[model samples]
Target: MNKQDALSIVETHLTKKRFEHTVRVAETAVTLANLYQVSAKKAEIAAIFHDYCKYRSLEEMMRIIETSYLPKDLLLYHHELWHGPVASIKVEEEYGITDEEIKSAIYCHTTGKAHMGKLDLIIFVADYIEPGRSFPGLEEVREMATTDLLKTAWMISRNTINFLMEKKNRIYPDTFHAYNDLTRLLDGGNHFEQNAIGNIETSSGSM
Candidate 1:
């Protein structure tokens, strides 16, 4: 489906406020895509449909998880994470959006995964730092996003682990894997450091 069609379908699945947030995420994702030289169209599509199943009832999501052959262990964690995976299925089955990049981005946007691609990183970070969102350390994350997308992703992943621990919530294994992957990427060498600095310069000029 095209951008406007995706937007219309997703808006119907979300509340007004959530729809607004989805729009902001799409806008942010497109900007990040431009910064990183990825496909803005894919990013926009992923962001628009990222939360397609957010408001689904727990019973409904559990049913989807069971029948759709999603990891049963997912049931052990809070249902908030279910929407990302479920939405990936729903979009493909319902809307005929079969793009694997977009599906992967939607699937991992909530908790992330190991060795995420650039489009996945863009959607994940855009969801976190979208203009409509507000939380502690958000501004810092926003600045980090401009400079080092990978590092920023690592920070978000670490923060999520901490938050889950504080809430006594069960942490998803994929989240840990994501954290480890980003940590390795950030620590590998001067390549990442140089890219971070270069992105900061470019972002400052454009944004």
Candidate 2:
């Protein structure tokens, strides 16, 4: 679907406050995409649909999870995470948005996965540091986002893991995987530098 059509559909699915937040996220995603030299169009689309299923009834989400053959263990965790995976399915089936990059970005925005692409990182970080969100350390993350996307992602992942641990909540394996992958990438100086250069080159080619 076109951007305007997608925005209209998403606004209908969310409340006024949530729709406003969605707009902020899209703007933030566009900025991050520009900074990282990724596709701002794709980033905005992914961010627009990121929370499409957020207000779905628990029963409806549970039904989608089962029918869609998502991990059953997901049910055991907080229901909030269900929206990301469920929205990915809904956007494809309902809006005919079959782009893997957009789908993957929405799918893992809530709980990031291992080896995320540039678009995925942009959406993930955008969602966290979006203007509508206000949380501890948000300013720091916002600053880091402009200078170091991967480092910002790693910081967010670590913060998320620590928050879950403090609450004694069950942690998703993918979150840990994301944390570890970023940790490894950032810890290896030469490898990190090479990958950073390569990402810029790839982004330039795509642009």
Best by TM-score: 2
lDDT of 2: 0.86
Please provide, for model 2 over 1-207, each residue's C-alpha lDDT reduced to its tens digit, 9 standing for 90 to 100: 557887898898899999999999999999998888887888888999999999999999999999886788789888988999998888888878877778889999999988788888999999999988888988999999999998999999999999999999899888998999889888874544554533533323110
lDDT of each: 0.86, 0.86
Per-model RMSD to reference = 5.9, 3.3
Tell me the TM-score of each prediction against the true structure: 0.89, 0.90
Residue-level lDDT for 85 in candidate 2: 92
With a 3 Å backbone cut-off (N, CA, C), the pairs that clash in candidate 2 are none
Q: Which 10 consecutive positions of candidate 2 have the poorest summed lDDT?
A: 198-207
Model 2 earns a TM-score of: 0.90
Count of backbone clashes, every candidate in sequence: 0, 0
